[model samples]
Target: MSELLDNTEAATKAVVDWLTKKAKTKSKFYIKDFYKIFPDDKPRAIKKVVNKMVETGELEFWSSGSTTMYGLKGGGIQHSSEGES
Candidate 1:
């Protein structure tokens, strides 16, 4: 699963895997970070999939000021807590 991500579909798994790791630490990550992973994939497509993840509750969305971050809900992370801090 360490291979470079090439598509949004593959990226969905990669995001889940990455978030799985973060789930252990309850760490949050950013949308741009996800976008940068798939250099060949369209940025819009990546964002769309990530949004889907959020919609499906795979990833939690946290908004801090003007910044929005995403983290794994599977890890028991809280979006409200993330934004408050």
Candidate 2:
């Protein structure tokens, strides 16, 4: 049980670091973009970590009407349903 917790923590850190440090130039990404960050880890696990970040307000969802992408909160242009004239 403890080992699982440790793994989860490490995975979470890795994802955050990649988003903040490595992918700093990019603002938004598809879920599939995270798969390579943890090549040995299952894609499902990667998705789980990213989703958890989203839930915790560390990341946010950006939609372009037809598609949705993810980005760090306040890191780049955010889409909102306001001021549309």
Candidate 3:
């Protein structure tokens, strides 16, 4: 419905703002980090918004082989798989 879309859009903007303004010094974040931003919302709902951002090209995935992270697209330390063991 239109209400659902509006809420999702608002959440998406809140996340983008947090990444750009509040957590500006950090490049990557964990899913748990977003819990602090939307304490009233269910974790599943938050994940939905974040994953949507990834699908929309607003964020990108970062991995260190063992762990996965999220960061603003083109705004964090570049990851290269060229020289790895």
Q: TM-score of every model?
A: 0.66, 0.73, 0.79
Model 3 scores a C-alpha lDDT of 0.78
Worst 10 residues of 3 by lDDT: 76-85
Tens-digit lDDT track of model 3 for 1-85: 2243349777787888889885568878988898777877778877878899999999887877998888788776564433577
The global C-alpha lDDT for each of the candidates, from Candidate 1 onward, is: 0.70, 0.73, 0.78
Candidate 1 structure quality by residue, lDDT tens digits, 30-62: 777776556666767778778888888777777
Worst 10 residues of 2 by lDDT: 1-10
Better of 1 and 2 by lDDT: 2
Model 2 clashes, total count = 0
RMSD of 3: 3.6
Tell me the alpha-carbon RMSD of every candidate.
4.8, 3.5, 3.6
Report the number of the highest-lDDT candidate: 3
Best by TM-score: 3
Rank by lDDT, highest first: 3, 2, 1
Model 2 score (lDDT): 0.73
Candidate 2 lDDT over residue span 1-85, tens digit each: 2243248667677777788875558878888888877776667767777888899988887777998788777666454433576
Which residues of candidate 2, in runs, are more than 4 Å off? 1-6, 79-85
